[model samples]
Target: MSSISRPSAAASAHAETIRFEAADGHPLEGTLTTGPGHGPLALISAATAVKRGFYQKFAESLVTEHGFRAALTYDYRGTGGSVSQDFNPRHISMADWGMKDFPAALARLELVAPGHRVVGVGQSYGGQALGLGNVSERFERYLMVATISGYWRNLGGGFKLYALMNLVANPVAFLVGHVPSGMGLGSGLPGGVFSDWTRWCNRPDYFFSEEPRFDAKNLFASVRTPILAIGATDDPWGTPAAREAIMRHFTNAPVETRWLDPQEAGGPIGHLDFFRSRFRETLWPEAIGWLKGEAQA
Candidate 1:
């Protein structure tokens, strides 16, 4: 509940580095962007292994540009600022990011902004985590960017099949208990996290394969919030079909998918570009407009 920072008057926004704990009492850290007071909340969840800094501009913009009361962004346990240098990757799993870490962020938002509407933007793996627990129902609306079922088959290339088969399904990842850096996942990921990710990616049903253990079907089906799912034509990992495959599980929610072409963006808007500051003028407004409309409706 402690926030540590002063407002930078120039931007009409302030960022506070706050410390919070998950339901499991797992300590976590994140940044809260807005004024000292609260109004409408914007929870910006990050992609797999993606840190809070990646969304700093977007979070702050929610307050200064989009008229949000506040925005929250954080790191999952065992990744980014939340984990210690000696952290053991084996202690965490991809499921924990949704069921545990995401809920914790929700609770933190609740503490900071009581009796107000909250909107969320879940990017990539973040969008998947939204359906993992009871948190999605709390948001007035949500926008998912580049979120997909990550099924290897949905993607093109025999190289993907070969690479995933030999690299991830083998003993190296299991023995090391982590996907080492330079694997293209940025900063790398805990072995437990990557293993669960591998399992989900291998299945067309993605996380549903972990059924019975987590009640993936009913858990996702329970969400009633309206969702806007965005897919980019250039994103190999989150193709339109791949994104739709996973979002289909939100049977109770009214979902909409909008595909963006790189040509319209004046450049490439890959799986990771939507949040980049350069798109603040082009793509971000589209997201903000949709969220405002949904949350108010």
Candidate 2:
């Protein structure tokens, strides 16, 4: 048999790159997509395992179809092409993300699209980051898709066991110089991000049990941004009760929650599929309709 050969392509076109100094002074990398008209600036944030390019299709829709002035997406520290391994990997915390990289991204966006209203669209872990970022009045609107504010109680038997393993793996990570496994919905985040996730997962209030710490409650209460929360009826991490719990945290802000059935949204769509689904053609139009204050029911 003949050997297989890799496909060849033309030279790559250059995309604009910008670097921001995070609140903690870490350099963060981002990509900017300028739109054809002056409209609200959209800032897209990705989940832990997802890179900035993960939002490419969505960003295109926001600019070309929705008329958003600009869309900016970035990788968190230690993920994607941003500064990697600059911080301690063994003991990273979500608080560090909220305090550092997220704020830097916001500052950079403000500079790039000065005097424009900003909207945040985040998915999964990225949605959680948006929730944390909402404590400030920086964004004009928020859209959280498949977000987890804390943890889900009923993530099935496999997730339950994975949660148990994370507790043991976190401390071991520090000793072995390995990242904690099972920190993400899938696998393999940076050691620092993984450790932070492990700490949050083991907490009773978020995942393993319901006895959440008082600080966790305060963290939820502090967020005052208006929001549109979206979830799938079949999502394992976003079960009805779990979604409601997340909504309860945003009582201080005006919130609209949408629980979509797969068939209704076009076809069978789960958590990740919501973004990668035809639902955008159908579901997003409705969501955007609601966001534009057009559909009220």
Candidate 3:
């Protein structure tokens, strides 16, 4: 546990820890950032293996710096403060994260701050979950950052190694009962999570056809909510084709696509860099401004 390790919020001036349950009645934890006289709510959905603390700074920014009335950052079951049971004993997959936890977070946010427009900020796997389990309608606006169909064939250059890593990694996960941290992935993952991730990455349709458990109706076509889908040039996995392959499913949403260049963005904007605090000046303005309807063309 680093400085960001799960804190009980201590009832900070602008943030508070809130405990909620996933759709499965699984216990979960989150932090809510809010202030007086705010507008919409921002929900920060984290990427696979990444914890809610990873998004805490961004969540605070939504309320502190941006116009959002409140922001909620939470961990899916078996991750962060929500991990009540050991990983080896139970099966947990993206479907659990998407179909169950994401909606529960949204419902909790609604309870905490009712009647406000809900905005979603989904990073990588976070973006995929919105369409996976029919939570798109809950968000009046959505932003997808580095969210892509992780099919290795769609990736280019060094990113093609994602598949190789999966080959090497999955076996190790099976042996160890978990996906050890590092090896390019940010955090240690439950064996089931890494299993689902690799299995989906193997398919052209990604999660759409990779798993029978993901049989929920494809809701991407049904989402009328406005979307901002951003691709980073330096991100190997989030290639233009990869991003397009997944986002093209949102037929009904007014999708605005943008590619961020490291030169213009002031630094290398990798897949994980978008949420990092360093880019708060150069990159966040356009992304956050768009939601506030204050973005420049």
Q: What is the C-alpha lDDT of each candidate?
A: 0.80, 0.63, 0.77
Best by lDDT: 1
Clashes of each: 2, 1, 0
Clashing pairs in 2: 205-212
lDDT of 3 by residue, 139-233 (tens): 88888899888787887744447655566878887887677677667677767777887887777887777435555335667778898888899
Models ranked on TM-score? 1, 3, 2
Q: Estimate, for each residue in 1-297, the C-alpha lDDT of model 1 and write its tens digit.
A: 566785643368878888888887677899888764344798888998688889998887778877888889999887777775555777677888899989999888877668789888899888887899577778998999998887877764336654754575434568877667666556667777877877776677878867677888888999999999998889877766687789989999999888998898878988888888888888888888888883422
The worst-scoring run of ten residues by lDDT in candidate 1 lies at 162-171
Per-model TM against the reference: 0.91, 0.81, 0.89
**Local error of candidate 1 at residue 281 (angstroms):** 1.2
Ranking by lDDT: 1, 3, 2
> Model 3 Cα RMSD, Å?
3.5
* Deviation in Å, model 3, residue 224 alpha carbon: 1.7
User: Once superposed on the true structure, which residue ranges of model 3 sit more than 4 Å away at CA?
Assistant: 1-13, 86-90, 157-164, 210-212
- Identify the leading candidate in terms of TM-score: 1
